[model samples]
Target chain A: MNIALKEIVKNKVRFSILGSIILLVSLLTFIISGLANGLSQDNASLIKDLPSGQLYMNKEAEGTYNLSRIDPDIQEKINSQQKEAVAFSIQMGFLNDESGKQRSVAFVTSTESKLFQKVKPGEIVLDRSLEEEGIKVGDTLTHDQFSGKLVVKSFVDQKKFSHAPVAYISMENYKEIYRTEDMQLVFVPTAESSLLFKDLQSFSNRDFLKTIPSYSAEQTSLNMIIWFLVVISGMLFGIFFYMMNVQKIGLFGILKAIGLKTSDLFKMMWTQMLFITLSALALSITFSQLFTSLAPKDIPFILTIETTLQLAAVFLIIGFIGATLSGIQMKRVEPLQAIQQGEV
Target chain B: MLTMDNVRKTYVVGDVKEEILKGISMSLHEGEITALVGPSGSGKSTLLTIAAGLQRASDGHVLFEGENMTTMRPEQVRNIRASKFGFVFQFAHLVPFLTVEEQLILMLDVSASKMKKNETKQEINKVLQLVGIEHRKDAYPSSLSGGEKQRVAIARAIIHKPKVLFADEPTASLDSKKSNEVMSLIRDLTKTLKMTTLIVTHDEDMLRYADHIIKMSDGKIL
Candidate 1:
């Protein structure tokens, strides 16, 4: 709008340096943000998509899905209040492939679930990530050193979670896979059968995640990693830009002496920094997503627009703060020096 | 025209109370070229800065066409300078980021919001031609020579077509030939525009251009 602004915008070297820095910060923040989001989803993707209004798991178990087994008596109380009850079998352990390679996986007892109800006997839904390790339909998955086997029935859209994949299977199929009859729960797919079981066992779906020992801890750790990235991105960006401004004392004084107001000059600096940050972040984020799509399956990087927006907002905020603190030296410019210092 | 009435300025250096200018009085006429001449410690630049409203006088009034500028707010003073005054410092402090054309336009871009782009551009071209740098319009300050920079500074000073042009040692950085060229251009431009001009210099060679020369020694006007 003014000479100071026009000059800054037109000055390629200064703007390029600033813009590139903002872009790097934005990209880093966005990637970390994406990973943070991806991490949380990985922790709960299987549970979050379950169709049941409530899931019943053992309150006595260490975790929601791992150690929790519904006390067979609570099923009766849950059935009296609901039209249907589906017994769910949740298991977490390693499953070996035909090639003798093992991968960590979660087993969902095939009960008619609201969210993921399509289950057939001898069939397993593979997590999206494990698809790379020779996982496909008709492949046999051996559980616990070949104690049992189940044919991979279908590979659904469930995401690649942190380090494991989820498989949904019928109780009979899960029983054969796990080599145990301890998972005696039935999915209340039919309305009438649910009432019969509810009189004997307690159940719920929403509180299922709370029953897992590692669920909350896993989520918190992933979020902590994400939060760490958020912080460092802005801090590094602000420091670099602040230092750049600190080096321009002579330029600022000349502008002030020639009657450029300090506030306007500051606004110009902030606007310049913001423009740079926003553009760079956008460019980096767009390219990163393309890279992610072309990357190998095991690398779990998921970028979303929501994550990018959050990252850009942070970059802009940090840029403004840095430019503001950096421009504090603007007030210290002795305008008189511009004139009093001899022309030599 | 610019006038300072019995103006006084003081400086504080710890316990020392040093008076820079002690009751200096002078009146400069419209369209007349005036020189403020003094030794190093005689407060010539101090008086000039106060008259330009860049600094405040400890006492007395500065008048521009009978307008009491002494009590004017900084904003008011800034407006006065933007609309009524042009300044040429000893050093041509052209914004390094801008070209010679942009440097001249910066003065006319008084408000950071709205700019007089067309008029300022027209004026820049006119002044460049007047100062004889029309050929070097696109050149940056870093690319310009010493005399060329002073010529650009003079071009910037008259770009706004202010009521008065203030030059503090405008020729101090230039050789004799360049100084004559810059001074003649200033005088010719001032006469053509009929704007009052003032210069503060220790250069006695420049004394010829001044219609009225105020001599200063020890903060006293002679």
Candidate 2:
């Protein structure tokens, strides 16, 4: 008979109110989630793009990547022991174009490896974002700290660090500008956790991301908002169903009196929950994906199918828990009591 | 046929044990209306509920046919209530969302009837027509008048062709004219279907339609 669906169709305004609330909440959640991912990519795509591995830095640096300096001897030893290992260093710096306009960049230099772009001492590769600002291949750029001029060899896509375009320079140029004889870190791709060295701490790829101060703080706050929305939506289902079940206690009792199974009542409530949640998720996913494609280039909004589906699954499970909890009252209702309570 | 052999029901509140039906015993014959008439708190309604399997008897046996219902499990009792019994309360108690036709269909589903699609529709129509509300089969409970809602409730109750029909003050909420109409309908259905019927009511005017009238006072038949 599908009494649940019939009730929803008959009382359109009532169910629509619940549906609209879920739609708005899930839509807001999707938008915020997209912004959070976008900001995360903007803040540290350079390290985030790296394959799963171990990162070793000086133990005395106290979890600060910039403060960590791996000795040249230790770097060479690890490099020899781990064939895929690479010693790398990054520092915030500025470059002046031929027109004398200064632009901030993260100057990164790494040992000869396939993991990073290999640039000659007199050449450089830059993130594509710099191309939008009129910098092109073969353009000569100058650094104030060094006397030599370097030509832009090419441009790479989406390589960024600390919200700035990454400029890949050679180890010789990096040492000349910073006057540092040692690399800041050693990265070994696909390395096991058991691999350790004296006077150094190893961090997994995910844990290494936490070493960046702005990355952790930003991600933590935004992730907290996402979880809060998820929980609020669950409670919304609880309170909303609680109220609806309360009003229909008499109806439930009457149905039970007529020999409807208790499990049947639970099924009815579950069917309604799934219907409402799936509908809202479909709309929110469509709108969020549309926003992803049409949003301004500077908005930094990125929503993927994987994240959307994961959140939708969470909403369904939470809503089911909420509705089931509220339905506990239905099991306790006595048909005799309801029958005595006058008409439903 | 249904029989009660010294059935008892007691309610305990805090430290006090109050007995509602004290050693009640009765029997309902096939194709006859048995009315339980009593004043308020006289336990007539309690007896009806116990006999209908809506509640448990504190002591003694409720035998339907040859099986003692009191010794059966709750699931078994519920199955009997779903398939072998029908109920009509004082109020219509129709599901507000379902139309008159859907109400009957829901009852058919609950009873687990094996009627096919066409047979189910024909049965629903037949019952609605018998209840004199065939034209209002598409109407929701909210739009139906009090009498029409009761008629639909009656149709829902009998759609499954239960063996025993239970009515608890079925016409107490209706006017005198409407009450007589409902009583006459119940009497006609009981004889026409050859089913055992038990009714609990305080309205003496409705007694003329019953074949057996048991007047109860202080939980005992007088």
Candidate number achieving the greatest lDDT relative to the actual structure: 2
RMSD for each of the candidates: 5.2, 1.0
Classify candidate 2 by CAPRI docking class. Answer: high
TM-score of decoy 2: 0.99
TM (B chain), model 2: 0.99
Model 2: per-residue Cα lDDT at residue B3: 97
lDDT of 1 at A299: 51
Model 2 chain B worst lDDT run, 10 consecutive residues: B148-157
lDDT of 1 by residue, B39-73 (tens): 99999989888888888899999999889898988
- lDDT tens digits by residue: candidate 2, B133-191: 99998898999988888888888889999999999999988999999999999999999
CAPRI-style quality class for the chain A–B interface of candidate 1? acceptable
**Which candidate wins on DockQ?**
2
Judge candidate 2 at residue A81 and give its lDDT: 91
DockQ of each: 0.37, 0.88
Q: Tens digit of lDDT per residue, candidate 2, span A102-212? A: 999999999988889999998999999999999989999999988799899999999988888999999999999999888998999998788899999999989998888
lDDT score of residue A6 within candidate 1: 67
